[model samples]
Target: MAAGIEHGRRSRPNIRIIAWAGAAALLLVPLVAMQVTQEVAWDVTDFAFFGGLLLSVGGAYELLVRASGNATYRAAAAIALAGVFLLVWVNAAVGIIGSEADNANLLFAGVIATGVAGACLARLQPRGMARALVATALAQALVGMVALMGRLGVMSSAWPGDIFAATGFFAGLWLLSAWLFGRAARA
Candidate 1:
């Protein structure tokens, strides 16, 4: 009985496996879509890059969630991870501020960088994650404001609507994450 129980525990799939599988499924969606529609076009490099990115980010988040004892910390980490993944994926798929190659879109990376630096500084503590989340939220807002300025004719972008939409979506996610983290910290 003891041996069977231990074997069962060892055989169960871990969080890493689940994360990788989920990431693979997400990447496969576009690959399958490309077969039926011309709207989804991805080269080998794009597939590999995005696949690797999703897997890496998902695995990292899974590890963080599993290793943390605090529920609040786990929630904060998950929010931050999701925000980073979405921002990067959106920017890589199409330019947030303009075309995919638009220089203004690069500014959004600062938000992710801020989160990473905060994680390092806070050592992944709940309080630190809260502060980091707020900082990232601020960074996202700044990026959105820049995109809004472009929409107002302050920058060069024919697709100001796209810029506004992307910025608004991502900034909202950042703000939500910040709010969650703040609540966690307070609790």
Candidate 2:
């Protein structure tokens, strides 16, 4: 009750519940669809992979809330985490540059690796986190540059601006997270 304490502790169980329920519910959606349509066919590995991914995201969120009380810090962390989650999901399911099997799409891993490495180097501090996110954004943009320049992947349809748009969107998210982390550091 002294000063500037967040209700993060109180929200811990709530987040855990949400994560758990979310993972189950999301996994169920595909399972249900599979029964109704052949188009939705998914193996056990797919279910396991996604189930693990959802839970991991939730766990990361829980840890972040436990580690920092600043709401801005929490928000920044959430953005970064969600960005990674969405990147992985979309890349695995549909591919970033072409399709899921596109060799160019594999480059997205660099963005993730940069984020993880930067986070480790920064030790998750607000200022360092900002830098990490910036690096992440750069990595994302670099992949786009590389893929587009090299014409690296096969596309089912003719390539439009999809590659440009996808990379830009993800890079923007990384920058947004970086900006929030910067604000948190200043605070």
Candidate 3:
């Protein structure tokens, strides 16, 4: 039993290292693919920016996981990390509300801002996280509503379905995170 326990302890760090390695590979694959295909079209600056972003996001997630003892808090952090990554990637790749150039895309910043505030409010505690997650979900839902309005002809050129799709997806994630936090708080 002691030997088994010792083996399990050693494997935790190994799992973390493996996770980071996978993150690096996920970023590297696009770099190599871009080199081989003209369709991908990422330059050096794009590579550097995305590579750094991936590393920082993945490293932050790992740090939070190691720092938090509560499974609920860890899961919440993971969800927030994922939300940030997706937001950044989508914003960088092709604007969230429209394309990279649309002014409406600026509203997406609120989602990230709310998340930052939520983290501070929650302080990685289950009850606080529950409150924070609800706030985040509400913010996300508001963003979706605004996008829906923009899609309904408030904006002439914006695509309704795409905007609604992205907003709803992120909102759903926030809601799920909120539910998890609520469950954790109850437990």
The candidate that achieves the highest lDDT relative to the unseen native structure: 2
For candidate 3, give the lDDT. 0.75
- For each candidate, how many residue pairs have backbone atoms clashing (under 3 Å)? 0, 0, 0
lDDT of model 2 at position 159: 63
- What lDDT does model 1 reach? 0.75
Candidate 2 C-alpha lDDT tens digits along 1-187: 5354466443234655766787789889999999999999899999999988988888888877777789999999999999999999998998877778877777888899999899889888999999999999999988888887888664547464777888888999999999999999999
Error of 1 at 183 (Å): 3.6
**Which residue runs of candidate 1 sit more than 4 Å off their true CA positions?**
1-16, 150-159
RMSD of every prediction: 3.9, 4.1, 2.9
Q: Report the C-alpha displacement of residue 154, candidate 2, in angstroms.
A: 5.1
Candidate 2 structure lDDT: 0.86
> Could you estimate the TM-score for every candidate?
0.79, 0.87, 0.83
Model 3, span 4-94: residue lDDT tens? 4674564235666787888888878887888798889887898898888888788778776765666876787778778878888888887
lDDT-wise, the better of 2 and 3 is 2
Segments of candidate 2 deviating more than 4 angstroms: 1-13, 158-160
TM-score of candidate 2 against the unseen true structure: 0.87
lDDT at 170, model 1? 69
| lDDT values for all models | 0.75, 0.86, 0.75
lDDT of 1 by residue, 1-187 (tens): 5643574575466656776777778889988999999998889999998988887687778667765666766776777788788888878876677666777778887988998898789876667777777788788878778768656333544566666666667667766766776776777
